[model samples]
Target: MRPIDEGMPRERTLLSWRRTVLAFSIASFALARLALAESLTLAESLAATALLVIVLIVVISMRLYRGSMSAVGVSTFIVSATTFLLGVIEILLVLKD
Candidate 1:
């Protein structure tokens, strides 16, 4: 068996978190564009943009901290779940109209 590199797991975890953040950012931008093109009011758009910014900031912080991979995992799940729900809601709204 090959000797394990102690830092490899942490490096992989951090890279996974970065990829999660990138995916979430893409999804958020798509949703925002859909909202702006469809039925979102200016106030609603601003609020959503603010929330996305805050979430992104937190995720980035978790990635940079290096204290705990748990924090990164949890934040990644939160962002992914939130984006999925928002996408579903937006689709429903679009279909309803």
Candidate 2:
């Protein structure tokens, strides 16, 4: 059993993270606008705020995750999972409203 090449895999992972973060940020902003336009309830507004915060955190994490081996995977997983969860929640909220 041979270990995989470290550099290429890491680079690909980083690029994927970058694309995910960009998509999350853009989707959050779009949802925020939709929520604002539709006069969302306080709870919904708070959810949007949470999504925005997650976007910011993910963006920042990308920078910090670049070279730190120990923390990179943790940050990437958190961002990716949160992004998917938030997207689902947003869709449900919009439909519920």
Candidate 3:
């Protein structure tokens, strides 16, 4: 295959990754912003903290963009897992209250 053909697939994949990052960043920021205004119980406070961590991860991801795709994918997974944990924390807080 030509050099241009090889780069085309990688370029498309990178574009898709950028879109995913943008979506995740927007969603995470909105969630964190809304969570900030809530009156908190201990669990809720921790959940808010986790949400903030995800926001931080998003910021760090931008800095590391030129590094490695593997590292970026790992960070994405961590943020996603943290998001899941935050959901669980919110659910428990609801049950506790």
Candidate 4:
């Protein structure tokens, strides 16, 4: 068995964490606006759900990134995909409403 490249993996993991933090921050701000709209609708609920899923994905990615034997790249991809999905859903919900 071989040991992992400690420094590189840590750097990549740190980048993933930074990205997740930024994505979550943006989504949180957007969610506030969606929640405070004139009427409560299904669109708002869907947007909220998307944001929640993004947050969960980010948290899970970070956890997986920190593990020694796990692959960090895949986790990063998952995080990015979820973030994109969150944004798309938010847009769709807002437009639909």
lDDT of each: 0.63, 0.66, 0.59, 0.65
Segments in model 3 whose C-alpha atoms lie over 4 Å from true places: 39-76, 86-97
Predict model 4's lDDT versus the native. Answer: 0.65
- Which candidate has the top score in TM-score? 1
RMSD of 1: 4.3
List CA RMSD, all candidates.
4.3, 5.4, 4.8, 5.1
Which tens-of-lDDT digit does each residue in 3-90 have in candidate 1? 5656687667667766766676676666666666665684367457746655765556565556644465666566667767767766
Return the candidate ranking by lDDT, descending: 2, 4, 1, 3
Name the top lDDT candidate. Answer: 2
> Which tens-of-lDDT digit does each residue in 63-92 have in candidate 4?
665664365667567666766866776676
Model 2: per-residue Cα lDDT over 15-78, one tens digit each: 7767766676677666666666666674477456667666666566556656544566666577
> Candidate 1: where is the Cα deviation over 4 Å?
1-7, 40-65, 68-77
Off by over 4 Å in 2: 1-7, 40-66
User: How many clashing pairs does model 4 include?
Assistant: 0
Candidate 3, residue 53: Cα displacement in angstroms equals 6.9
Clashes of each: 0, 0, 0, 0
How much is 23 displaced in model 1, in angstroms? 0.9
Root mean square deviation (Cα) for candidate 2: 5.4
